[model samples]
Structures are given as C-alpha cells and as structure tokens.
Target: MVEKDGIVRVGLDAGMNALVRPAMYDAWHDIVNLQRIDAPADGQFDVVGPICESSDLFGKRRRLPRDTAPGDVMLLADTGAYGHAMASRYNLRELPPEDVIDGPVA
Candidate 1:
C-alpha cells in the first residue's frame, strides 16, 4: 500500500489471490487511522466499494477507525495479490491503471 496526495492505493494480483471468496467467507482487513490516532488500535471493518453491487468489496470485517468517512481513503493491505487483476469491465467500467512504485519489483 502507498499514499500520495492524500489518496491511498492498493494493488492486487488475480492469478494468485482470492478476491470474491474472501468476502464470501467473511474475511476482513484493518484500516489504520494514521492522521488522528498516534497509535491506532486494531478493529474490524466492512470493507466495500462505492459501486453498486453485492460483491464489490475488499473485505467484510475490516478493522478501521470508528470515524471513517466516504472522503477518507483506505488502503486494503496485501491486496497486491488480487485487487487489480480481478477487476472486470462490467457495465462498461474501465479497469484501473497501474504504476511502477519505487521503480518496479525485481
């Protein structure tokens, strides 16, 4: 996960990671409040997307700050395994672009 311009970004690889099953199986992640809490605690969250769909989500029981909002950005950790790769062009939705961070992985 990486943050730039107050926006946090996460990566995923479809070939190796399981996306849909995680949510279906009731999995979740933690959303650390880096700005407010000097030491944030681990909590559960219902990780989801703004898009309209029943399966559009990253996690079910994600841990996040109690004050999370729509404008607040959240980086779904360890998503570099399935985030981008599994995205579909559903409803003519465009796929998210990728960038090389710190000069690409070896």
Candidate 2:
C-alpha cells in the first residue's frame, strides 16, 4: 500500500489480533526492507496493519528504503518476544500463521 505522498502503508495479514503493543502504548517497531538493505532512506512511512481502527499501526514516520513499495517483504524487528503471544481476535481478524525457521540466524 505505498502511497503517492511517500508514505508506505504496510498492511499486515494480522493486526491488533496479532500484536497490540503498538496501539496500546505507542510502541515503536523497527522496519527494514531485507531486499533493499543497501538502499537509502528517502522519506517517512506509516507501517500499519489491516485492522479497521486507526490505532492499529506498527510504526509512524518510519524511515525505510527509498524504493520501498507494496509487495516488498519488510521485517518487523523485536517481535519474537511478545508478538504472537499477545494476539487477540479483535476486529475479527485471524491471527497470522506461525512459522518455524530451522536454520542459522542471519
């Protein structure tokens, strides 16, 4: 959901149902474009989820790759500790499917 205003609207498959930290306390999550790690930061972005509420955001004014756009897989850092554990059924959005990475840490 990249907008013309230079704000990338990133919608996650899951929203408040899978992570409430952001909407609850204005938590800040680091976002990175793994495919464009070397790209420069062109402007700010609003990394959000698919939730209906406006508070269902991951990061505000986040600095990401200048070429960042829709369909690009961005990594939300530091969510392993309490991401899925804090999920709920709010907004009737289903929780995101879980995955287990069985390899060396990148």
Top TM-score model:
2
Clashes of 1: 13
Error of 2 at 12 (Å): 3.0
Winning model by lDDT = 2
Error of 2 at 59 (Å): 0.7
Per-candidate TM equals: 0.50, 0.77
When summed lDDT is taken over every stretch of 10 residues in candidate 2, the lowest stretch is 4-13
Q: Candidate 2: which pairs clash?
A: none
**What's the lDDT for all of these models?**
0.46, 0.75
On residues 1-106, what C-alpha lDDT tens digit does candidate 2 reach at each position?
6575655676666576787888888777788877788899776778788765888788888887767776777777777758878887776666777765566778
What is candidate 1's local distance difference test score?
0.46
lDDT of 1 by residue, 1-106 (tens): 3344654433222211234444455445444444445534444454545453656556544455545544553444444545566646655555555543454556
